[model samples]
Target: MSEKINVGDKAPDFELIKPDGSTFRLQNQLKETNVVLYFYPKDNTPGCTKQACEFRDQYEVFKEHEAEVVGISADSSDSHDEFERSHRLPFVLLSDTGNKVRNLFGVPRKFGIIPGRVTYVIDKDGIVRYIFNSMTKPLEHVKNALEVLKNIEKK
Candidate 1:
């Protein structure tokens, strides 16, 4: 794992493949809005499903705060596509097949086995304002991210 970043640290830049086979660059998205970039273990799993659905349901709230919620996983583009479509997720799901972005953010694995479930709240200036790491409380990810974005907007 790479060095863990702090709250005020500049978020590392990365590019990953989206569900449609297009590239998603972090720098470009950060230019317009804050990003709720979440790294999950897999697609269609129970915890991941609940997490994604929570993000989907609260997606409009994120948009109201001028934040973009994005999910990243090592799942392939086809799996991502199916997951998005099946779940009716309103946000973008990136295919981080190489786990490069996960390592870039130093998201640790659970028990040195499963991939970590981490959520990062990054501002438009590319600073990481908050990070929530939890393997069980999946719904809390959406709630915490919204809270952080609201606080950031107040500043």
Candidate 2:
């Protein structure tokens, strides 16, 4: 895998399919708001579910900070739909079926088996302000992202 992107790097842009079968482009989102982009291994799995739920629970906090949270995985749009419905996830869940976006972000694999879990806080100008990469501490992704966004909002 390529070296993990740094905090100040420009975020790689990608187009992904949303659970609703519509397409979402990272650049388009950046035009309006800062983005909290997270890459997870799969949908409905244990760790992934906890991470998603944490994001769902703190989604209002994210919005109040003027940031939008988006979760991505290699699952198909159909799977994302079911996962979103089951979890009542308010933010967008995108399908990166081929791991294209995952690779674009250079998210490493944990134990060389599952995709690495990483969260990125991208400012409105499309520059990444922070990256938290951890396969085990899923909920920290939400906490770290909120902290970064709160700082960004203050500046």
TM per prediction: 0.98, 0.96
What's the TM for model 1?
Answer: 0.98
Model 2, which residues run further than 4 Å from truth?
1-3
Give lDDT tens digits, candidate 1, residues 50-128: 9999999999999999999999999999999999999999889998888889999999999998999999999999999
lDDT of 1: 0.93
The C-alpha RMSD of each candidate to the native structure, in angstroms, is 0.7, 1.0
Candidate 2 clash pair list: none
Against the true structure, candidate 2 reaches a TM-score of: 0.96
How far off is residue 73 in model 1, in Å?
0.7
